[model samples]
Target: MGQQTVNEPPVVEGPATQEFAPEVEKLINTVAKFTVLVSQKLPDDVAARLKELAEEETAPMAKMIYSTMARNQDLAWQLKRPSCQDTGLVQLFVRAGTDFPYLDRVDAAMKEAVARATKWSPLRLNTVETFDEYNTGTNTGSRSPWIYWQTIPDSDSLELDVYLAGGGCSLPGQGKTLMPGEGYEAAVKFVLDVMTSYGINACPPLLVGVGIGSSIDAAAYMSKAALMRPVGSHSANPKAAELETELKDAIDRIGLGPQGLGGQHSVMGVNIENSARHPSVLSVAVNTGCWSHRRGTIRIASDLSYELLTHKGVEL
Candidate 1:
């Protein structure tokens, strides 16, 4: 949440004053360890979705592929290793109250976590300079391992949505701004266009995120953010939920299946996140998340009590 926030909600500071300075360092170290744990383990929600999708698939080859995906996940857990060879990119979506004692340390905590995770989880060396093309090896660099933040007013907890943005899925991301006359129909058409044009390579069944807002960048950011949400959770708005259902159905009909092999369902789910739009412009963006769909959410309370929402019963 570097600075993609639209307009931050009002936050009232709590007891995180000068007396808590020592606690800040501890919190950073805690977050760093949590990052390593997240990197190597597949979240339960993703595993459940894969199981559900596998059951729905009727094609022999597709079913076999899903079985293999499940086996890979099993082996990763059994061996306590990364599920994929290309760990891809790390992106953390954070929600924290301004009053949290460790607020100042959040950014550093995240960076330190990424660096530590590279060696601990043994993550792939994904950060390279833009033009120079030299690997940083540690996955920490200028704007690398991006973190998105949203502040929750009157709260004293840090909630993190950690995601491994695999390169295969990110390759198909695209955004566009439709003119006033284009209407919502045009937005759906654009999503369909993206799926047909590029979804196969990303390794379906995909979790499709569709973002609609006032501008391309805004929508693009939301689209990526949407992926961080729980896989099957839809927007609260009825219209938005309907759009999500329609998009999921339509995209699944594309039959990209597991690893792009033809089958009954192409996508596991389609999630739409939207905000008020400028009357003259309807900006939309689409992001695909592959079957692995590695994302997890963890929350740490002011009292230091912790919970892993996506991975139940996890102490960290």
Candidate 2:
């Protein structure tokens, strides 16, 4: 009081802003942990199917190899290690609500989660720049965590589907734009032809995803989307759903079976994705999934709370 000294106010820090819901943050971490766990564990259904195929396989050598594979998968799961040497590329399909709280930072957070998962799960460094050939040992780089986005109306949460797509399985994606006059029959025939020719190499009991639309690129994208449908799920459109069933039947009749050793189940399922197209053009695309069929999905609320769709009972 006597000196009347002037003192400046002290700077105070506020609490950190939470861009995402606590539930969402928890879910993301859970997914990251499960991704590694799933890579190591072959689900019971998959194991049983493989066993049935091994027993039914006519090719003696193929059966023997398949038996060995089943044994290896069992060992890997028991040991908590990756089922296959190639952990594959991580791809995420995200359906987010417009009202999602952490909408802006969701993608960035996902990329960081992938990187962390790669280190914690010790995922294979699969991403490499096409021209530069730089391996991003962390399983992430520019666009390394591939994401497909959709805005869900009137919802408060987000849904995420993750796929660990192996190079062998993804190699079969193909599309062609045909003259409209070529007709839907022609498209169906083309799909069959592709399967008959290369389906064996793709590792059957395949999940067949077909896309039909205006342009080759659009169709190609739809085809990949079809792969996200659950096994035995059909398109919502009646005609499209019928096509899925028919195609599944036709493919199964091919007798390619599990591992292409030949059996009753050439494909486990088929799904079709379609779009309205220009009058003059008909585009068709096809993508295949191997028997391993490794994929996981999660849904989050606008408030950032989430649910894991693919692997039931899994919490984040």
Candidate 3:
């Protein structure tokens, strides 16, 4: 990210602004623009990884598909439209500092931002009520634009990992509890089984996220969070990093290639995030991001200055 300072004057001019209404409006606009940006352009790491995969692909048909994907992205940028028709269900992974002045307002601001983005980006209406089963049309519904939060201690910044969880990629996500006796090897097996069975449906080369933890819910959350990491990054834990490499190599060997038609690679990379679990319990979850990997990270400082950590040389 370029870390450029926003030069626009504050949306409101006043000294008695304790409510921070001006800041909220600015945040809403910034997030709305970011939503659109990610829809049209892949993150820097994802874009680079795709190019690498395209070069490594040797199958004639797969290579052609890769070229088509490249052209699709180019057209998306040129036309300033969504690269994929399913712009996806909006999700924000929030890491908000406890000291952040606007903590209480973040939720409303983000929801409003999504509403604005829906119209501005012309985002596909993907939110539907569960069970009741009706599309909201506005891309907002009960519990839609799901926001996952983590509070930071003794800090004053807000960071967000925004993701467009498309239906294809969402279809392959799975989590299950394994007996401790089955061991980590079983976890590996679970990942392989899921990908081998459903990877094609996700539109490879995928960015596979694996989470191991004490409970299914924890594992599922971590699995999705892992997708927010840069494409080729590895876990800090040596064992986890090794698992990542092993899984990545195994998935690549599957030969799903571009659009899963068949070729040399099935995934951009594998990321493993783990949490210590009760001795009796082992839970593992797998989540995948399709090749487009529509996601971005932004860090906003106390004064509301921001950095787009994933898309360098870009501004909202």
Indicate which candidate wins on TM-score.
Answer: 3
Tens-place lDDT per residue, model 3, 1-316, is 8885534332432222234378788887888899999999999999999999889878999999999999999999999999999999999999999999889999877877787889888899897777666566667667668999999999999999889999999999999999769998899999999999999999898999999999999999999999999999999999899989999999888888889899999999999899999999999999999999999999988888899999999988
Per-residue accuracy of model 1 over 267-315 as CA lDDT, tens digit each: 8788888999888999999998888888888888886667888888665
Cα lDDT tens digits, model 2, 1-316, are 4775434323322112224466556655765776776676644445555677677667665676677777877787678677777788998888888877777877767776777678777788898766556675678766778999898887667787778888878877788988769899999998999899889887777888999999999999899998887776778899999998899889888888667776777876788999999999999999998877777666666654555566565443
Candidate 2 lDDT trough over 10 residues, lowest sum: 9-18
Alpha-carbon TM-score of each model against the true structure = 0.90, 0.83, 0.92
Report per-prediction Cα RMSD to one decimal. 8.1, 11.4, 9.2
The ten-residue window of minimal lDDT in model 3 covers 9-18
**Off by more than 4 A, model 3:** 1-20
Ranked by TM-score, top first? 3, 1, 2
Give the Å error, residue 146, model 2: 1.1
Q: Where does the lowest 10-residue lDDT sum fall in candidate 1? A: 9-18
Better of 1 and 2 by TM-score: 1
Better of 2 and 3 by lDDT: 3
Query: Comparing 1 and 3 by lDDT, which wins?
Result: 3
